[model samples]
Target: MWISTSFFMMLHIPLRTETTSLMSSGKTLRKGVRKMKREILYPELTTLYGDGGNMLLLKQCCNDAVFRETGLEEVPWFVSEDVDFICIGSMSEPKQLLVREKLKPYKERIRELIEKGTVFLVTGNAMELFGQYIEDRKERMEMLGIFDYHAQRNLDKRLNYIVLAQYEKLPVVGVKSQFSQIHGLDNHHFLKMVKGLGDNEGSEFEGIHYRNFFGTYCLGPLLVYNPQFTKHLLELCGQKGEIVFEKELEEAYYERLRKYRHPDSPVVLGHGFI
Candidate 1:
């Protein structure tokens, strides 16, 4: 089932039998274990950094709730036939260029899938290329334009911890690190913001939201520290039923959050890439 508020969208997916059995078994299963719902990570041309942790957390969350998680790499690879969610992680400028080159050939298909209401959670620089254009130091490159907004490198870099106010009744918290500014769209409403948009871009323009796509600048493996937001994303991916918080998983999330609460927190930089 799908649930939506003015600023946020939620999807609830029913648990499958195989997934429940695996969780109940208490066995150490490999990464790619049960298969039911489809979840893809665009890893071919992107440097995910801590986004892998985000995906893992989501998988574990689903497992706790008795739902299956599958990852898709190449286009031709098997994708569980029914994709519930598609997540793209943060990428460096060079890696993004390479991924875009590979994706250029499949632009039409990608656009079609996005328009079909496929749940997409894009973070950091990965979202820049999904828009009209990205302005880098060297030159300006055309993007997928799936979103109406445009991204341009800002003269100053924005790096700080944020406390986003509740939007549509869901609490959101994430860090922001970007040298880019988004413009050209006014109709679309942002989820919410409680901190910096760099040079004070404006209130209603902190983030981007259109259809089932959600783009944000939150860096440090966002979903891991934000279970409420993660659960909301899963709901958008067709997750149906009660959102029962798993004790172990919830503890793990809070532990990580405590480590990364402050901007100067040691956990912030130790994770390699942000």
Candidate 2:
């Protein structure tokens, strides 16, 4: 039986709050899971900073996946059909506005899918589209309002960081490169910052994790850099196959983790403009 979306909201327990809790709640796929045919939706205009690699990772992991791509003018496949996963990458600041406008019409459907536990991975600034608004020195642009958060954008300055965060027992490492910082996120954060700035300079949390929807500023090659997390994701999608390059990916992940753990490693905050 499918769980009701309002029930989860009323309880205030996000589906992917923590690994242990998630497992205990029986929301995750169990051990010895079998492969299932997955339909993946890839929407257009969110490709930037090599974030498109997220989709490639999914395709590589799920051999029986059926992939669909939609342009800005075209209606997304998920609007009419049920999709197992939806992945969107980073895009330019101008493109963000366009994409937001294009997706505004389907905001309710997106929210419903997220509540139903359809896996969604929105990386980099693409995540901001689901928020309340994006404000800059020039003007304020309204967003989807699926979440209460808002973003502050500064076109002049860019913030760069190599973040090391913990998600339950897993170590998550990624690059955060953005001209904007998110605000108003509290309970539904995706990662706990162990050594880096999050959402903004004052915040300790990074990204959004509501139900199976994962929205983050961590840009580029996220899946390739974290094999364990990828494996977990495959399991979440009902696949329990071997990762394409498990050994090599784990080596790279641990090496990066080692470097990130060092005291001297830098989390560069360029200009510190919010």
Candidate 3:
């Protein structure tokens, strides 16, 4: 039901509709400069599965965006300054704990930022931070507890799904493949899962969407597969920017979505002890 910039996203990428302008290095601009600020957390470790493209997508989508980033030891500037967007992408399980610990000190600040309209896109394992805790067998890992969900790592069965959901009038699509599943937001969900598992296979619902917080397990460089969603983000921030390589991006997105929509598409599921 949803198609606009999305029709272009389905086209497939030799164009890298996702990897456009990438900005970083804590560069400060003029005080009166009205550029949108976007911050990425621990890119070195969390850029797995091409999720780094999300940052590039944002940089290009928001031409005035002054992109900044933080390392594991550095405090995120969003804690003290205004930022339009904050991104935390995919990382391994061990690194997840490390990042969680680094973020623990900023709980109150994160809460405040959420209230003030700072959008956060926490994808893959990074979403564990927003939950109350994550359990791997008998061991338990505490999380930020911003949302009521509790994540449980599936040591035996990792799930991989081709996600298709509806966001307003747009038909949202992405890939959801992970070892941990979250539960708790039965009533409040990101979208109605039309196909494939959402938070978990048992749940028909997927993700959690609040004022500006968008947490999901979907990968496939979500923004790359869904450019319309990126545009929606700009609108949510009250900002405007143009999509780079629209024609090529559209073609790439179409090619990729075609493969995904195929009934006999190839599946990539890993078997690991994590």
Candidate 4:
């Protein structure tokens, strides 16, 4: 019942450009349109588990988004300039601590931005960097404390599962592979799990949501797996554009959903890593 990250990456759909409308406040973008500025934080470390595809798909959807791959040593674009969207993807457990240390100084800035409704997409364990602390058997590391939650890590075992969750009527489907489970997340959940373990083994809610910030442990190109959710995300970014290969993406989504929802599907609990 286990699926490799490459299984999601090898969609085999041909990429093609389509005309898209990027609108905000009843205004349509025209010639010389100001491009949407986006930042991918620390791509060198955060691009784990094929998460790089999330930004690629996002760029294709936005059409004219100016993307900055911010390195670990460079200052983040969101710190000084107005950025339309910021994304941080999955990384190794050790890298999470490094990222936390790098962003610790900007904790207040990040909180202000989150409160201001800046769009943020944090996937996989990268979301843990925003929590109060991360604890494993060996040691405890303080995180950004942007949120009130904490995470417990068990390096000996990995939790892997196919998730089917709902975020505002949209069926979100993705895979979660992590060595940690979040704790102390209250009502600020991003998705309600329909058929998967969430936050932790005992919780039915998944991810963290505050204003426009979306943090989830799910990985393997989340934006690509859930086209509906991606469209919703773009709308939050002040974009209502046609997704490249939209038809193909939707078809694939339905197929995956159907299989997961099937009564005899092996991906259900007791079969897949729950």
Best by TM-score: 4
TM-scores for every predicted model = 0.68, 0.82, 0.83, 0.87
Question: What lDDT does each candidate get?
Answer: 0.56, 0.74, 0.74, 0.81
lDDT of 4 by residue, 1-274 (tens): 2234554455432222222324312446578877788888988888777787787777656756666778889888888978888999999987887898889888999998999988999999999999999999999999999999999999998777888889977889888888889999997899899877799999999999899999998765798888888899999998896787688788878888898888776543332442
TM-score of 1: 0.68
What root-mean-square deviation over C-alphas does model 4 reach? Answer: 5.3
- The TM-score measured for candidate 4 stands at 0.87
Q: Largest lDDT belongs to which candidate? A: 4
lDDT of 3 by residue, 8-51 (tens): 45433222122213232345556797766778888878877667
In candidate 4, stretches whose alpha carbon ends up further than 4 angstroms from where it belongs are 1-33, 268-274
Give the per-residue Cα lDDT of candidate 1 at 229: 74
**Span of 10 residues, lowest total lDDT, candidate 2:** 13-22
Which regions of candidate 1 deviate over 4 angstroms? 1-35, 44-49, 64-73, 76-82, 154-158, 161-163, 198-200, 240-274
Off by over 4 Å in 3: 1-33, 255-274
Worst ten in a row by lDDT for model 1: 1-10
Candidate 4 has an lDDT of 0.81
Rank ordering of all candidates by TM-score, starting from the highest: 4, 3, 2, 1
**What are the RMSD figures for all models against the true structure?**
9.1, 11.6, 6.1, 5.3
